[model samples]
Target: MRIKETIYKWIFTIFAFASLLFLVGIVVVLFKEGLPIFKHVKLVAFLFGKSWYPTYEPAEYGILPLIMGSVWVTVGAVLVSVPLGVGSALYLDELASYKQKAILKPIIEILASIPSIVFGFFGMVIVAPLIQRIFKLPVGLCALTASIILGVMAIPTICSLAEDALSYVPRSFREASFALGANRWQTLTKVVVPAAGSGVSTSIILGVSRIVGETMTVLMVSGGAAMIPVSFFQPVRPMTATIAAEMGEAAMGSAHYHALFAIGLILFLVTLVFNIIAELISRRFRIKLGLNR
Candidate 1:
């Protein structure tokens, strides 16, 4: 028994170490390839320059438009998803009976499991045409369309995580609040949600991260325009879309290839920051709740 246990522990430890080793290898490769772009274009020019005419005679490589595209879509997605997601979570945790909860939770998980390309196809054939007809726009493919799609995609993630966070609040907390004369609504708002604030916040941040990293749906529905977006109605191209659309055509050792890697590096950093923040929040909350000894 002892020998078997020792072997199982060593196997698990090796798997864990392999995962870390792969992560470090990816980071090193990303930096090595991405850093070369600076030799062709100055850092500030590549980051903030207005034009992205990489194929033009002068070969401008500014990524400001791509950055703004991601920002606009992410912000719009947050606005559309946060309220609905959080509300669904609250309803599931506090209002729903056992039967309703069981049915809805599985539906949410299924929604999360649906392929991204399916969402893109749906957006193109269904949502885009609807938006164009409703708004009387020249085209339906724009940041708004991408935002709506990504928002729907993010909903399952937010709802699932937030519901789990709410479930983690001790039953005694609700009983105490009731004994203090708080009604269900007051107890939920003042006591329960506050107790799960860290977890709720973590869920939200992770949802935003998912939005930021999305590629196919945005590429299909976001009009594929490589210009800074001034309104939701305007077409925009996010960094991920740019990479996906152009990487195949860029030469292996060209500046354009390095530039795509640079974009990936920026995206990697942004995702890392969001994850770190979520982890910190969850850890602090766990320690405060005495769940971590």
Candidate 2:
């Protein structure tokens, strides 16, 4: 038994260490390839410049438009997904019968399993035409379209994790609340949600992370316009889409190639910061809930 336990521990430890090493290797390579761009273009200009004409004479590489495009789509996705996802989670966890939950949970999981490319195709073929017809827009491929698609993709993740969090609230808390003559709505709103706040927040952050990092769906649906957008109806290209669309055509070891890597580095840092904030919030909530003990 001792020998088996030792072997298992060593195996798991090696696997965990390998995962960390792989992540470190990726970061190192990203910085190594990406840092070369700073030699040619000033960091401030590259980050905040308005133009992104990599093939034009003198070849501008401002990523502000890309940043804003990503932010707008992500914010739109969050606005659309959060309410629906949380509502679905609350219904499944609190209001639904066991049979309804059994049926719906698997369906939600199935939605998550659907590929991003499929969603992209659906948006392009089905949703785009509808939006164009209804809104009288020249094209349906815009930030709004991308947002709706990404929001749909993110919903399953947010709903599942949030439902799990709500389910984790101790039964004693509910029982005590009921004993004090609290209604189900009061118990749920005041007690259960607060208790599961950390996990719920984490789920929301992870959902946003998914939307921000998604590539193919945004690329296919976001109109691929590398311009600063003023409205959801306007076409825009996000950072991920820009990288995916241009990286193949960029010459190796050229300024354009280096610029793409730099964009990737920026994206990595942004994602890292988001995860860090989520962790901090989760930690605070855990401490407040007395779960850290």
Candidate 3:
């Protein structure tokens, strides 16, 4: 038994170490390939410049438009998904019967399993035309369309995590709230949600992360225009879309190639920061709720 336990511990430790090493390796490679761009283009100009004409006569590599496009679509996705996802989670955790939950949970999971490319195609074929017809836009492929698709993709993740958080609240908390004459809505809003605030916040952050990092759906739906978006109806290209669309054409050792890697590095840092913030917020809330002993 001791020998078996020792072997198992070593195996798990090696696996965990390998995972960490892999992460570090990726960061090292990203920085190595990406930092070369800074030698040619100043970091400030590359990050803040408005133009992104990589093939034009001086090969501008500004990424501000890409950043803004990503931000616009991600914000739109968060606005659309958060309310619906959280509400669905609340219903599943508090209001739904066992049978309803049983049916709906699998359906939600299935939604997550659907390929992102399928969502992109659906946006192109179904949602895009509808938006064009309804809004009288010249084209439906824009930030709004991308947002709607990304929102749908983010829903299952948000719903599942938020439901799990809600479900983790102690039964005693609910009983006490009820004993104090609070109705279901009041108990849920005031007591249960507060108790699971950390997890709920984490869920939201993770959902945002999902929207921000998504590539294929945004690439197919976001119109592929490398311009600063002035409105939801305007076509825009996000960072992920730019990298995905242009990386193939860029020469392996060229400035454009390095610039793409730099964009990826920026994206990696953004997502990493978001996840770290989520962890910090979760920890802080857990401490406040006395759940972090």
Looking at model 2, residue 116 earns an lDDT score of 97
lDDT of 1 by residue, 1-293 (tens): 99999999999999999999998999999999999999999999999988898788878899999999999999999998888899999999999999999999889978888888999999999999999999999999999999999999999999999999888888999999999999999999999999998989999999999999999999999998989999999999999999999998999979999999999999999999999999999998787666775
List RMSD in Å for every model shown: 2.0, 2.5, 2.3
Residue 122 lDDT, candidate 1, scale 0-100: 98
Weakest 10 consecutive residues, lDDT, candidate 2? Answer: 284-293
Clash pairs for candidate 2: none
Among the numbered candidates, top TM-score falls to: 1
How many clashes would you count in candidate 2?
0
Off by over 4 Å in 3: 1-16, 285-293
The residue pairs found clashing in candidate 1 are none
Better of 1 and 3 by TM-score: 1
**Between 2 and 3, whose TM-score is larger?**
3
RMSD of 2: 2.5
What TM-score, to 2 decimals, does candidate 1 have?
0.95
- What TM-score against the true fold does each predicted structure earn? 0.95, 0.92, 0.93
